[model samples]
Target: MRLPCIGILTISDRASQGHYEDKGGPAVETSLRAILAMPFEALRRCVPDERPVIEAALSSLCDNDGCCLVVTTGGTGPAPRDVTPEATEAVCDRMLPGFGELMRMESLKQVPTAILSRQTAGLRGRSLIVNLPGKPSAIDLCLKAVFPAIPYCLDLIGAARLETDPAICPAFRPGK
Candidate 1:
């Protein structure tokens, strides 16, 4: 089987500048590695919380790098620097609002501050981009909530086919 190409982007001014360690990006990588049973490769990037930079990175990953799925961490809060969602919307061909809604809804069960999160997901060409919060625990929570449909979404977008371990993350697809 061909390996799936995935992009992992971390949007944080401090982490990008090397002022702080990036916990969220690694969390995403670990989660994907643990759950995805298919052959896959990840292209990782760390950038500051700037809309233009994020937009450029997203475009390059989806268009140039040929990443079927681009998962971004950080810049989903109410802060002015939090423009990951805006950048994602700008580059994507369509918005998948259900992802953000479901993430927030699931996270609300954990923390009341989930209302402040603006996590979102979208599609650019054949690539699916998901904006996630910076916190590592929040990453785990959000991924668990929405990842069941991600593989199928990528399949529908003509990007790649992703198979998951049923015991770890049983993906929900019709006629499974």
Candidate 2:
């Protein structure tokens, strides 16, 4: 049995240039550690806020690296350079808007700025790509909001099997 591979891509111009620390990527890794019940490897990448770079990274992670899931941090806000969602939509076969809806809805409870978040998720071949907010804390909140359905989404897309710790996040796979 192969252990699952999760892609953690951080999109930030300053972070990519070493001008700022990449806290969002580490935050995702921490959440994965707490939520995942089984062993898995995280394939990490950091790139500037460029759509082409983001697109290429997504393709490489899903098609070449054999990653079943790719979670991107940053470039989901209303800023001029925020284009992660667009890059994601371009490469994905189908868009799952509910993930964004749930994330924004959950985030709204914590801050009014959640409405400004344009986070989204989509299916790229067998891989599931999720766009998360740049803020480290928001990443945790958004993941908590949508992660329960992630395993089942992966199942539906024929990706790798991912089991979550019941105490941390009880994944719902319907009738399981």
Candidate 3:
């Protein structure tokens, strides 16, 4: 069987231009590896903070690459360049705010500034796109907080089945 594809998109000007190393993309991949037991390919991309570029990348990942899940890092802040959420919303058919709400609620326990985070998740075609903060530490924290529901969400969206390690992320499915 072919391995399922998961999109790992890092949105940053410096990272895309090679001025700075891209840590967010790798951080998301590591977190996903820890949680997912099933084999999959990480279809990674690094784009600048431009909204149109971000939207094109997201659209390509879902509509062309057949990625079941697209997880974006960075550009979800209050800054003017933080347009990841806007790009995500534009490409998504349905928005899932609960993911962001839960992530923020959990992140708030670790840091008082969690309220500043604008993380969110949505569906584009059959792919589920989740926006996360730029910080590496925050990426794992947010993923851990929201990953349990990911597999079930994928199932609902008709994406590739994602099995998780019970110790790492015990995915919740009805009647399991």
TM-score of 2: 0.98
lDDT of 1: 0.93
Per-prediction TM-score: 0.98, 0.98, 0.99
CA deviation > 4 Å runs, candidate 2: none
| Clashes (N, CA, C under 3 Å) per candidate | 0, 0, 0
C-alpha root-mean-square deviation, candidate 3: 0.6
Instruction: Pick out the ten consecutive residues of candidate 1 with the lowest summed lDDT.
Output: 1-10
Q: Write the per-residue lDDT of candidate 2 for residues 114-161, one digit (tens) a residue.
A: 999999999989999999998989999899889999999999989999
Q: Positional deviation of 56 in candidate 2, in angstroms?
A: 0.3
lDDT of 3 by residue, 39-112 (tens): 89999999999999999999999999999999999999899999999999999999999999999998899999
Q: Report lDDT per candidate.
A: 0.93, 0.95, 0.95
Candidate 1 displacement at residue 57 in angstroms: 0.3
- lDDT for model 2 comes to 0.95
lDDT of 1 by residue, 68-110 (tens): 9999999999999899999999999899999999999999999
